[model samples]
Target: MSLRVEGLCVARGEAVVVRGVSFSVPLGEVTVLLGPNGAGKTSLLEALSGILPIQAGRLELCGREMSRASRVVRARAGLSHVQQGRVVFPTLSVEENLRVGARDGLEEAFRLFPELEKRRHTPAGQLSGGEQQMVVLARAILSRPQVLLVDEMSLGLAPLVVKRLLPVLKGLAEGGVGVLLVEQFARLALSLGHQALVMNQGRLVYSGPASALLRQPELLQWAYLGRSA
Candidate 1:
């Protein structure tokens, strides 16, 4: 499934949030959205997921246009999003939450993150932050989406936990799913993604091979290491 965003623009009321953002996530690989806070990364993800309206431009899933698709239409078309904040049903059991990811159950995500299996009966709110986030992702994966838009998977988690998550994401890309990961840490995004796009004030500033960004110390400094933008 090829996911294409051509001149995609999103707005909040009359104020534009994501302006003319164009990029393509070819099937079977990971593409990272690198940006600072308030860069419209989450808004773009919302647009792609059909949760927010697009003020202008287009989104294509496979060959179909999605700029005006309903939320259910988007979900059934194989687009899944794990938004920031890991909003799970606090009262729901872990297994119940996993069930929300897919009807067939938690086997696949449990296979990917075995830790979930052991605590399947616990309440979602009882799990640690990383565990809860994994449960959220597990549910999204169960939807069997071809395109996955993940926002801040590393937010407020230990580096080691994030380190573990990236490999599972890699396996997803290797298996022919398109991943659009919105990341706070450009270093991690560049290291994990096949390609990277930098977003600032809702516009894409730079885009190219992850390795290319990785090689330029000055660019990394501007992005994650924190010198200039």
Candidate 2:
């Protein structure tokens, strides 16, 4: 199974943000979406998650066409999205918030995030930013999604925390989940990714193996910094 996008276009009323974007994220692999700010990475993710209408093209999750599906339907069909920022329910306890969409995997969530297990009864709003991010991750993991979309997950977190979180995403990919990660830390994302996709000016500038990009930093420099590769 895989998440397939073809000739995708996204708009925010009157203005187009993503234009004719296309890619494939097969199961058991990580596809890193890298770009500078305002490069339309987030807009692409939003369109895939059904949060924004697809202005054109097609989206298929696990072989099911889902261009017109609602966000909740897509989620139920094994597409999970963890958007930027702490989206946990502030008034709810950590465990309560986790239980909202979880059909199972409660223990697995706790196992991946022991910190949350220890503070399961605590209000989600009281946790630190990193801890809250973990809560969101744990909840998403518990859903056992076929396609997981994570946007800016490591943003505003400590380096160590970012390090810890990335491995978990890798583990998920290893377990047969298609993970599409949008991140600003280009090197770190490439390190964990099986495939690297770079966007610039709302278009895909590069799409290839992660190792190739890592071995030749010039390619990244050309895509991101406009230097010769």
Candidate 3:
């Protein structure tokens, strides 16, 4: 496993948003996390990335324990997180954004996102939503993380643009990077995933093969509705 999270718990002030969640992201595979809004998916990713402290859990990356590691420490340990909202340096050019973390890997990033290569010199703020997302993803890839946690990569983008981005994640998984993806579009995400984990009311309602969950709409509906399956 590239990333192992066991009995994870996260609290927001007095409220506990994530409760006893556990799952693993294996190398060369995509683990799709599905749920409705306010399901603690973002909080879980934040905890794993060390942006938010975990209340209780065991986090292991590439066989090393990093439960209490700082965000920079986690990043250096081959963990990268592409957060929601397409965060980027608005004034920076696409190529400049890719160069923020590491000087190398520019070629690889451009290769992975050829559309970016065309606008490498353009400021990120001037690009479209999908292009900005591509820039964020490209920056994360430049870090060469062993495990990548992406939250809502398709947010606010058209279905056509989302279709273009989803395959890139699958390709990364095939290249031996463990990818944990939290997506709103369940069906599209499941099609490219090997494992599936469904969340509801801050807890996991289902965990199994992606294909298994894909074939059973009732189970997913139950999970989304916060009903046990």
Each candidate structure's TM-score, on Cα atoms with residue i matched to residue i, is 0.94, 0.96, 0.98
Report the poorest 10 consecutive residues by lDDT, candidate 2: 220-229
Specify the poorest-scoring 10-residue window by lDDT in model 3.
Answer: 220-229
Tell me the spans in candidate 3 whose CA falls farther than 4 Å from its real position.
none
lDDT of candidate model 2 versus the reference: 0.90
lDDT of candidate 3 over 120-180, digit per residue (tens)? 9999999999999999998998899899999999999999999999999999999999999
Estimate, for each residue in 1-229, the C-alpha lDDT of model 2 and write its tens digit: 7999999999988989898998999999999998778889999999999899999999998889999999989998999999999699999999898998585777888899898899999999999999999999998888879989999998899878888899999999999999999987778889999999988878888899988899998898788763323
Best by lDDT: 3
Model 1 per-residue lDDT tens digits across residues 1-229: 6899989899888789998989999889899888777888899999999888988898999999888999899989999989889899989998998787677856777898799899988999999999998898888888898999999998999988898888888888898899999876667777878988888788887778888888885775565432334
Better of 2 and 3 by TM-score: 3
lDDT (C-alpha, whole model) for all candidates: 0.85, 0.90, 0.93
User: How far in Å is the alpha carbon of 207 misplaced in model 3?
Assistant: 0.3
lDDT of 3 at 116: 92
Error of 2 at 81 (Å): 0.4
